[model samples]
Target: MRLRVQGLYVMDASKRSAHGNAYFTGFGKAKRIVFFDTLLEKHTLDEIESILAHELGHFKFGHVRQMILQAAIIAFIGFAALYWAFGSETFAGWFGLPHDPGVVLIALLFAKEPVSHLLHPLLAARSRKNEFEADDFARRIVGKEPMISALTRLTRDNLATLTPDPLYAKFYFSHPPVPMRVAQLRGAVEA
Candidate 1:
């Protein structure tokens, strides 16, 4: 079950953030695996290899495609709302939105900001779920203990917020918190 793909690209991102990351870029056969230089520098060979295993798991399970589809659907819904708003005077009147078409973009942004905040938790939950699936994929490839070690190492080296505010993490985090991910991996190993 070899996962076939394209190149691996390493990036220097230490100046931007205290973090280690790996991502799959491009699409289909052109996809490239990317690694932060900090990640290569900080982690052991096994840890880095386990991280790659996890990324491959994402591709194997089509998580990347699912995310793209989800994003497109959300964007479509947003555009549909805008189309309806622009076409109906009664809808515009209900919101007291300015009739000036040029200012609508700015007005829409202001209106959506608060609404986006309310949607943040749901979005974060979906993203965390995807991370868990990827972790499961990694675990299957590298074994749970190694996957846990890799995730833990990434968190420590990146100086991740170890004890984030629960509410804030729920609303903002794309990946599950480090300890939580480690525990999940441990649970998988036990089971």
Candidate 2:
């Protein structure tokens, strides 16, 4: 499994905030991993390696490409919907909107808000599943204890929500809460 990681660098994020994070970005040969300076300050080398492994899991699973494709499909659907709305006078007339392109476009923006909200759970669920897969991949590479320790430290240092409401998490959280992730890692170790 060749990652073809192009660059590894740290950013001076502490100048603005103390939040700690690491991320993998780009596609194919352009891939890069970046760590917030604050993360280096807060975590041990082992923890950092665990986090790096987790980021690499995203690359291993092709999550970046999957996300890009999902975005493209959504954008295409949105444009198609807009085109249909523009041509359909009944759609505009239903809301007493003028059968004009500009007016219909404005109405579409308002109309899409509810649909976006409805779609939030599905999108967030996929994102959270990807996060779990990444966590598990890191566990496989670096051991669950290190990954769990890194996650625990990240949650504490970042002042993350400890226990979000289930419904809220389902709808909004792109990653499982720290405690949830830690529990899953611990369970995986036993199994």
Candidate 3:
């Protein structure tokens, strides 16, 4: 993992938002881990290390590449749909608009919410599963307590929902609710 890491950087994220976050960017041996300055200020060194371990898990599991591939597939489908719509004179006409690219784009914008609604559950489920795997990996690397503490702080600091409607979470959440994650961590520890 050390060999794969290219750099570690701290961004002045506090200037934009008080929310704390960290992420790894690039791919393979060129990967860089970037931490929000707010995260540095708010968390203990141990907590930061736990977060780093979680990110490392994503790399180890190739979650990043998988996400990119998923996005590419979605984009390809979207572009294909757009191409089809362009050729169909009835596309814009369905929206009571002219058969122009600009008008079609506007129609697509209006359609985006419903389309996203249909796709969100599947995408969110995959993302949540990845998050759980990452959390487990972090537990293996740094133990569960530090990661749990970090999650607790992040939830409080970010004003995140501790619990949410199950259906709503299925529709919109990419990560499981904090309480849910913490329970899973504790359960793993007990196991």
Q: In angstroms, give how far residue 9 of model 2 lies from its true place.
A: 1.5
**What does candidate 2 score on TM?**
0.95
User: Please, what's the RMSD in Å of model 2?
Assistant: 1.9
Off by over 4 Å in 3: 1-3, 90-102, 188-191
- Across 21-128, the per-residue lDDT of candidate 3 in tens digits comes to 998777767788899999999999999999999999888888888998999999998998888888998888887788888888878877878998899999999998
The lDDT, on a scale of 0 to 1, for candidate 2 is 0.90
Reference-based lDDT, each prediction:
0.79, 0.90, 0.87
Report the candidate with higher lDDT, 1 versus 2.
2
Q: Comparing candidate 1 with candidate 2, which one achieves the higher TM-score?
A: 2
lDDT of 3: 0.87
**Candidate closest to the true structure, highest TM-score:** 2
lDDT of 1: 0.79
Q: What is the C-alpha RMSD of each candidate to the true structure, in Å?
A: 2.5, 1.9, 2.7
Give the top-scoring candidate (lDDT). 2
Order of the predicted models by lDDT, top scorer first: 2, 3, 1
In candidate 2, what are the lDDT values of residues 46-111, reduced to their tens digit? 899999999999999999999999999999999999889988998899998789999898899999
Q: Flag clash pairs in model 2.
A: none
